[model samples]
Target chain A: MELLGIANYLVLFLTIAGVYALLTLGLNVQWGYTGILNIGVAAFFAVGAYTSALLTAPATAQPPGPGLPVAVGMLAAMPVAGILALGIGLITLNLRSDYLAIASIGIAEIVRLFLKNEEWLTNGVRGMAGIPRPFAGVDIAGWSAGGALYLALTIAVIGVVFAALQILYRAPWGRALRAIRDREVAAEAMGKNVLWFRLQSFVLGSAVMGLAGAVHVHYAGFIGPEAIDPLFATFIVWVMLIAGGSGSNLGAIVGALAIWAVWSVTELLGQIPEEPITGFGALRVFLIGLLLQVILLLRPQGIVPEPRE
Target chain B: MVELAQLLIYGVVLGSIIALGAIGVSLTFGVLRFANFAHGDYMTVGAYLVLPFYAGLQLPVAAAVTLAIAGTALMAVLIDRLLFERMRNAGPLVLLVSSFGVGLMLRSAVQMAWGPRTLVYESGIQLPLLFGPLRIKPDHITIIIGAVLLVLAVHLLLTRTRMGKAMRAMSDSPELARVSGINTAQVILFTWVAGAALAATAGFFLALDTNLRADLGWHFLLPVFAAAILGGIGRPYGAIAGGYVIGIAQEFSTLVISATYKPAVAFAIMVAILILRPTGILRGN
Candidate 1:
């Protein structure tokens, strides 16, 4: 069997990194810019993926494909995912930060549980397969040009969202969000509706998470309940935000890419030639534990602290 | 009448674990002032710790358990001293995320070490005690007795011992305690050791009934948190009572709903309590 070329592996990594970057940016808005500390960003991402996949995946008595055009399915998936986030925020966002974190964890689980158990809707644990790739006709021979194409699309989508977020960050509304996040009571005293601003952040973040999910499903060509497990959502997003620098949009993207590099390298390191290492796989986990412990101990402010400016 | 008795009996047994686990979690949160998302993993690690020594090494069950408890406690202390102590002044969010990262590391490590398979420790001693209208296992009886004794010990230590008093004082008001010349760091260490020891003990009991799996603590995490919140954060006794209540509610909820959904019951109670009475039944912060 032939090994994957470096270029192909790079493309795969970049595409995954791009999707995670989008998701991390959404979290940066909620946790960094808005101070919400949502631990369940994965749930909304799952929602968008499932909603679009269900809509687009072929059904009995229907054509054998995700039924709608890729673009339309993507569009419809966004608001549905946003609404779900809004529902969650309305119920749990009013609580204290710790409480919100706990609730978000629960909410993420609930979403995964629903998708896992709701076989009729999500096809249960088997997951939806054979998801249509965009611009399939332009595929390069046998190299899975689909990955490069998706990487391009992911870059495009991220560019649009990043630009839009940039606009929002400078706008008066974004300033209001920053104010509320810093001091909710003081922001309220200043005539800003704190709850409303928070809710807006939730909706917008969820929508971005949803869009990221849409790109993820289309790129991977498979979607599953386990894909949105709280482990990946909570841990990965937190790592990216911490490593990336939180409140900065650039920080979120950079963090996502950098952490992905760390994770991949660690996984590769686990495969190094070491005979009789006695639980080497587990050793890597211990390494991650050690790394996190050291990072928290030495650099709680992270590699790049959210810039004051 | 029979059904109610069974519910109460099962609830107490389940509650025993919840009570122990919650105290571990709540005490950490109370003293440290941040949510430790990884506390659940301690339960999983404790359970996993016993398997290697008890099953793999063929050590006697009691000896293996002692080792497990001690090992888990040491691990907790090492984590506190090595990781948590350094973040003494960071935002609570940093602590929370750190706990999560720690949890992920611990769990993945267990999975890698143990290969994600569930293993049961074969018991050499089984005294299946019989009670009128209620079947009880010897392990269950041991767990209840142990819980009661530990609770008493903790109470005495808190009220009678200088270290315990210092811990309570610090938890109540760290600044005042510091100003009053109490060694707050020592008190914090005591809190972790005590809490982690109880948590590991509970994890041992949990492994005794169900096989030890990597996700055992994650599965139990919600209920433990629910119990802690129901009893009110920072109140050890309240957490114990809340544990049993939550445990019983969880097992009984299965009678009406699917057994798989039993876990959600703990979370539901937690959400209700948080929304309706954030102060909780015992009214601690």
Candidate 2:
């Protein structure tokens, strides 16, 4: 590919990676800091994406969108995602972690099914299109300039989220979360109100995921059921969070970028000459799953191990 | 009345598949103490493994099923040795995540080998048998009978045999069982064998009842888990009852609601059960 072509792809890749970093950070807060096993990342994500799409997309005859301002739609995403998480967490968070995992995945599936079947709300499988970009009509120097601007905007969002999370992780409340995660019994005995703290973390983290979804949908200018594969979205974020050390905000960002690189490289490899394998897609997924196994076996703490107090 | 009876029969047949799969899930929970997320994928693998023998080699259905069961059992043992056994000391969350990874790998392997398209054992559909107001298929009878016999066999194995007693003992108290000279490792192996074989049988019958697709087991994952949980985790008998309830609820749901929401029925039952009675109907440990 030519230099300009490569730059465009690079900008797109970085933008997507930044969005994923937001998600990884959100997951890091829930699973890493709060010890909540939320397997419904995609559900929250879809909630945000659809919420924003429905609010911001131009009024259409079939889907019947509100066509509100993009900024308002993005602003609406966090509460929408947070409320859903609150409802789910209230019911299932008090149970064993296993039950939480099952319940979360079930919720994710329910969300997906609703999105697929509720034609009146989500346009069914046809999905919402022509979602306006952040600055669609802005005049730029070149064609690639818009891509670069979006990439910068995504990075800025990531930086703010990362900084906020970093400060939170180092704060007393964050330490309490860590304490709850490491030893819930001890934390509860210390009058920590463990469930309350966990609920906060779960809601906050899910809202961040919703924000990431808003960023993603805006960048792509579309939202659909096909946009999110429940398993791939959830597990890949997991791989990123675990592979990059959990409990560390920087690790979440690092993991997101590194895993995205590996993911894209594998996809590129599948496109190589000499008659690529017919099942290359499945093979790539298999390799990713194997990578998770290898990491768990060899480095359970991940590349950037959580810092000891 | 006939329609209700027909739905009940269909529910029972569907419940049998869930029951077979849930038995393994509950057994694993009892022994391993972690939800094996790959159990559903194992079901798919078992069904896919049978394709080579039943369709590719044109073998008899019985021989093919036997081969598939053995192959799946071997696969379970291999998985235990390589992935799960090594993580015996790890926390339940770690094991659960690892199981997710294993499930992904298995699913992808099935897709890679079989392609994304659906495959069926036989092309043409058989006419349903009518008995008065009731209509059923030979496949339904086979599924119902197979499930009952398997459940009965498991009951016998647990209650009548020495190994079964050892398993029960271990599940109750592994440390005590160890002190009592029960071979923990061997019993664990036996658990996997039994669980995998049952799952394979369920997968086979499910494929026979429906069509074989990569997502066949994936789709069943939630329902099976719901059954296992509803019957109470780690309680095999509870899983059987849970399976029937879920099956009947799902089939009957189509009468009032759209069929597309069938999977959600299991989720609803599971959530309600967890909220109302976390221990399930059987009140498992």
Specify the highest-TM-score model's number: 2
Instruction: List where candidate 1 sits over 4 angstroms from the true fold.
Output: A1-4, A60-66, A140-144, A268-285, A299-305, B56-60, B123-133
Per-residue alpha-carbon lDDT of candidate 2 for residues B1-285, written as tens digits (9 for 90 to 100): 889999999999999999999999999889878899999989999999999999899999999999999999999999999999988787888889999889999999999998989999989979999899899999999999999999999999989999989988888888999999999999999999999999999999999999998878878989999999999898889999999999999999989999999999999999999889988999876
Residue-by-residue lDDT tens digits, candidate 1, A1-309: 236687778888999899899999888888877888787888889888877776776544111354776787778778998898787677667777777778777777778788888777677788888677686556576666766777888899999999999889889988888898877888999999777888899889888888888888888778987765557565777778777777789888988998889878877776676754566656665665566667667665567776675
Across B1-285, the per-residue lDDT of candidate 1 in tens digits comes to 777787777788899989999988878877778778888889888888988887789899878878988888899889877777777677787777778778888888888878866777774667666677767787788778887887788789878999878877877887889999998778788888888788888888888866788888877877888888889888787898899999899888977987767777887888888879886798876
Put down candidate 2 lDDT per residue, A66-123, tens digits, no spaces. Answer: 7898788887998999999999889888888888888888889899989998988888
For candidate 1, report its TM-score: 0.92
> Chain B alone, TM-score of each model?
0.94, 0.98
Docking class of 1: medium
Which number leads on DockQ?
2
